[model samples]
Target: MNSRRTALVVMAAMLGSAALADWARPTIKVSDSFKNFKLDAVFPKSFGDWRVDENLPVIVPPPDQQAQLDKIYNQTLARTYVNREGARVMLSVAYGGDQSDGLTVHVPDVCYVSQGFRMGETRDATLQVSGDIVIPVRHLMMTMGPRLEVVTYWVLMGDEATTSNTQRKWVSIRYGLKRQIPEGMLIRVSSINPEMDKAIPLHKDFINQLMLAMPENQRDRVIGRVSVKKDDSRS
Candidate 1:
């Protein structure tokens, strides 16, 4: 009789938690904020010394995995760019209109792992995108036999940057309490380089230039708040 009573109590607690969660979830859609977020419109093909590679096309994932990506993301961009020196970088971006708890952007590590690549420990870093504009980014590497891919990436929940699940949850709670829903996206760049030291900085250079290429409003949408301190000294 005691065992059955304990089981009933546990079930009751679960049911109560579910009801509370449903009640706390935000319903108000902040879609207007991201209505102008078109992947093609923002990302440029030729930026800095880089130009799209006509010969080396971007790789599309397996049909099954791609189908899953299609369901989650409203838009995605994958392109390869080669510099004047012949160095190439691969850029991928995924954005969604409503990135609710169940429909968040998939991390690149998981995507690469599913494609049979061995992933390294992801390290957090910051990318200085021109003057006074710095954004948090992540660095990692993927390996498959002889091929090594060094990657730098970041995730955004609306204007708030959330790099991990914990951060995402906190952002979600903050939005939920305010009765607002936020969009989400994954911005990634990678290169096939044997040297991690060299490859990492190249990715940063690529990102910095790309962000610089974007117009103010378009760039602001991805980088969130642009709170730059004004120069009090007279020019």
Candidate 2:
């Protein structure tokens, strides 16, 4: 029986090594790269009725945590915006040149959990930016003691936007099979509000206005290609 167990362990080890070898093999080639785009320039300073709040305190991970994040992401931007109505929103975007099987963008759920915030309800949502231009997103509420926040985020895998981690993995594998390594970005927008019902609509309005203000060419980085059919009447 011991000898049989030893043989089984050996087989398992061999299988693990084979899988590691496959993942390490350079079978993927990056046909198109997003490395050249500047993330800072992609987002505007003032958009619609909102303006940048230079005095607003932006929360970021400490040096040790940030060091770890730096290894995963090539670039990151964090900013706060406020409108004349006294509403405020925080935006964060992280981009990586290689979003292959082993390396990928980190989602807010993981980050918030790591930061000691209790993750609340999470669901997939679609944001109608304009006439028939809907973008997929993940919405969740997070709380730490009495402080509550509503977060809306999305991951851009190449030109496709998805909220499912499974879908992101499939996209990476599909591109890997085609010998193409895809780049990806994670965009997160959040606001402090205990009332999720009202907070969500405000978040959507902020996104819509922000997207409208962004340059046409750079908008895809924040919100991936709109796949919904166009409403000619609205256009």
Candidate 3:
């Protein structure tokens, strides 16, 4: 599906579901499992070949748009980093303690289109977190006027990656049944590149490098694999 179709499908699913809005209230809190969960402190500013570039500018939402974001997100972080080769990537993250919005609406697919950017179809993809751990993700190709940007993103819910709205809703309902409220973190990586082939691998490497630098539990918050490993160990 194209961006418009994808956006409409999600919006329809959201607006049509009265049950979701009512039942989606978080009952129990599910911690991110990190001692002190601070996005700025948790994620490294300089990792591997990439380092924070003070001169680079990342996309900033208008004041009105930021107001809406503030309501949903407890904390938000935005930064631009440059690899040694001079390539730059933008990272945007939003964390909410009770992200039981039925299906998360704060995604690039939804918000980018709303912001006048022409997003292409959002495709399902995978990112190899380590030697064995792989996580599902969504890739977006967007443009506004003469600029082209490629994005890779995923949402974390209860140590699981929820890339689709249906997946997000299912995660919420499952946790709600247990009287648990799942925390949510939307991690997005974007770069200005016309060639997606080149952009995606760069994103994967950048994320893998960054995650490897973090502790296992802290890393799983972004990639979602804490319980999975524990379950594997039990076997």
The candidate scoring highest on TM-score is 1
lDDT string for model 1 (89-197, tens) is: 9999888767767234478767788789999756776666657666666788889999989888878776765568777777777777977787777888899987777
Q: What lDDT tens digits, residue by residue, belong to model 3 across residues 127-164?
A: 66666687777888999998899999988887688688
lDDT of 3 at 192: 92
Off by over 4 Å in 3: 1-26, 32-35, 226-235
Candidates 1 and 3: which is better by TM-score? 1
Tens digits of lDDT, candidate 2, 1-235 = 9999999999999999999878865455452455468887888889898988989777777998899888877889999999999899989988877777433435888888888999998867677776677777788999999999999998888667878778788878777666677777888889999978778888888889988888777887666673565423210
Error of 2 at 30 (Å): 4.7
Model 2 clash tally, residue pairs: 0
* lDDT of the structure predicted as candidate 2: 0.79
Model 1 TM = 0.83
Model 1 spans > 4 angstroms off: 1-24, 102-105, 226-235
Task: Identify the candidate with maximal lDDT.
Answer: 3
The lowest-lDDT stretch of 10 consecutive residues in candidate 1 is 226-235
